[model samples]
Target: MVSFKKLTIRDILFRSRMAYYNRPSLAFVGQEPVTYADMAVIVRNVSGMLNTLGIGKGDKVALIGENSPNWGMAYLAITSMGAVVVPILPDFSGHEMESIINHSEAKVVFVSAKLYGQLDRKNIPGVIAYILINNLQPFDESVTTPTAGMPYETPKAIVNVDYCDCELPRPDEDDLAAIIYTSGTTGRPKGVMLTHKNLVSNVLSTLMIQEVNENDRLLSILPLSHTYECTIGFLIPMATGASVYYLDKPPTPAVLIPAMQAVKPTMLLSVPLVIEKIYKNKIKPELTSSSLKRKLYSFTPTRKLLHRIAAKKLHKTFGGELHFFGIGGAKLSFEAERFLNEGRFPYSIGYGMTETSPLLTGSSPKLVRFRTAGFSIPGQELKLLNPNPHTGEGEIIVRGANVMVGYYKDPELTQTMFIDGWLRTGDLGYIDSDGYVEIRGRSKNMILTASGENIYPEEIEDVINKHEFVLESLVYELRGKLVARVHLNKEALEKYYENLKHSAKDWQHNAEEHTRKVLDEIMNYVNAKVSKFSRLNHIVEQQEPFVKTPTQKIKRFLYKE
Candidate 1:
């Protein structure tokens, strides 16, 4: 019932309050929920405190914290008053956090108690005050006089004891709203400048494709600091009057299973890794455990029927009411996507980056195509640049209301980010005649062969990763030859060896030999599927899982030749 005419975050909140004041708005899992009415009060109170601290329109404020009710409240409070919010990823190292805070020239910082120690006073000299996110209290920086060997009290109360009476500023649609530093896989972080219109426009566009009702409940597992979750998981749901629950801890199996049952979420948004892990570690083994079972799974009719049954169980495991299970952040494994499709799971794929307020193309469950990122979103103009005639592959560029303004304080970087007014997404992909966008890979990650053929490593890695014993794989060029560094499924490998113990005379030697054979088999399997130029010359076993960004994408630069 919220008014769709609202163009800014502040106005959206105001209209949502008018429509659904008594409706549940936000909650931390296992904690009491906050109604829209209650949230309005907290946001207003914190806004007043910020005003008293001299924060106002155009001033930059930094927020670093895990996803929580308070984190959302702090974001709303700052942006509502027309101030710029710089959300730092909590997983960033102390130095990285300090660098961003200083670079943004944030006047005030709202930090979680757990990460308070990461802030260095000397590093962020521009910050005037630090506020604790948990209780919305100010950290005392003034020296306290000792009395009777006990230090005098430092003022902690920042929120007004009485209801906030200060009037909040209304931000223009074009006014700066946030500065989100990108956690890119390579290169220094760049702060993407987003306006009030950029975010609100994306939210409205997303709503056009996906529906969220007051009755719908959302289970938020991604970090709120991430643009994907911030725009879709938090703001879009808020605009629709849907309640969102944040996990108190990481969304591991132990924590997520119980939370799903308790929340009974109707919408679930996540990166591909979450579902891929579940499919590979749990479901795949069950389906391929025995020769008979594997044989049963190979037949199309029988396989589809079996998958449908398994999908029902998967649906129940994810709270049973999930109308939409959105997968984004990265391409989902083919094996997992096949399972979801065969089982008829209500899942869809999305594609975008933080620079686009995080959504440019997404398919609803009914409109999804196999391996495609869906059609271009409404209100966005998407085109392929410098196309290859034969393959139709090119860099995907977009121009729309959701597009970011520019990189903060970096004119040269901003200039290179756009071409002819269209934002260069740096992603290589092609749109089919049917209008489905199929991403090839990051332009920077693409390898050029000696024959001048463009090879997408992601395509090759996908095939490598489908092997049962391979947990994940990174494909790169070494000495002009295609090489894949694969992380084996240690647990699955151990279990396989244990099963072989009874059959082999020397299990250790046989295990090593078997590992080599399987590795060769995996290479053969991948090479058979890919083009000649994409064939792997070697497959090395990675001892550890690759380091990943906040959204679970591997840092490919670290493994680059």
Candidate 2:
């Protein structure tokens, strides 16, 4: 258990010191497992370096990278020193990254080697340096003559610095911690300003629910720029003295599974898409085999026994300490919930936005429910605003210490996002008698049926995702009819027979045939379960995955009905 410390600079420094003193043996897995004491030393050094560079209280410092121990260390060093940290998303383009750096008024940027060239020095104003994270190939010298000392050529462009070892600085808890930019359903990305108190409060509150410990190991693969990853991945682990691991490459199953096996993480945190894909591609097909096999597996006695065996095998694959599997970022499918429930898996679901330090509500170990995003978290006050008379559902409004100060330099947008004192979540949901919040869908994503009935695209997409051959699917309306564009699994199709040539051209032909077979079975299966209004009108094949967020949630705004 973490020793409760006063929420101050001294307290965080105390925590960092405790990590060095007590949990020095703990390992953070990246290219290798690094000790807590070593990490603290690095943080201290980096802080000193920042202080030497004249970066102190309230100054914005930018970092762009995928998830890694270095990213977390950099953020901690910056925030601990009272400087505002601006984490640029790995997916951001050169223009987008530049805009954020300029808008946030970041004096210096620590960027990954892969993205160093994305910086068009001309666009970034008032920036003193662009520090290469790993090692950028020393800029091309052929374009212009090289600088006097630096490897890069000196033009009118901005100066680039090479990041090296540094000492750490300490910041007070009242300081502005970070400015996280979130691209909403519409309009430009808005930077949500969060203070150290706002972040540390949410981290502690989340830890109260997640119940992590020094013995626990967290595997972090989500974009560090996102608030969800920032709070849960970095802060939660640091406070609990738990070690963190991150994938070196993108989190595709090829890279992720190997990393998971190597790390054997005690907790796996992810959005719904990751597990949804596993269930759709891996589990659902086994359920749809032969009628006899399906019936045998569905029997209560047999199914429960099978789940027990599967869970045991899964635990072994996860290094025998896998206690918690957290799914958030989007609503989970009911079918997937049923499978996990039957397996008695130790899984939890949560719901939040970047504005609330991203943890408004979460499930407890003893009180987890599959359908709801769980009860309101500690320190958070939740209320419904303007319920629909017919539906009894309304927007989820939140007020808490974890809530952000406001959108950076965008008071108009910030004002619109909040109502009175509560942060308007824009999610349509209702709190049940049990105090659990059940979400229906985003208010902006709701579609109207021809009969004026409201339909949630997520609802239909959930059903379509249960298909065996489908990797992903997006539900939308086209020409006044509900349509689903399904992305078929190319590898799975070819592997279906072990020697089949299920090429792209064959996808259109095979997709129709496969879709017909799968859809017929699914339609017949789900017909009795859903209302007449919830049925899909058509299903189309999509060649590519839908554009999604870092969490793998489909960008609804990019797709039209």
Q: Give TM-scores for every candidate, taking all chains together and pairing residue i with residue i.
A: 0.94, 0.86
Q: How far is candidate 1 from the true structure (C-alpha RMSD, Å)?
A: 3.9
Worst 10 residues of 2 by lDDT: 151-160
Per-residue alpha-carbon lDDT of candidate 1 for residues 416-516, written as tens digits (9 for 90 to 100): 99999999999999999888999999999999988899998998888888888899999998888889999888787778767876444565657667778
Q: Which candidate tops lDDT?
A: 1
- Report the C-alpha lDDT of model 2 over 19-116, residue by residue, as the tens digit: 64555322334354555666666666666667767786889999987666667767777787778999988888889999999999998787766676
Question: What's the C-alpha lDDT at position 457 in model 2?
Answer: 78
Model 1 ranges with Cα > 4 A deviation: 1-6, 141-163, 502-517
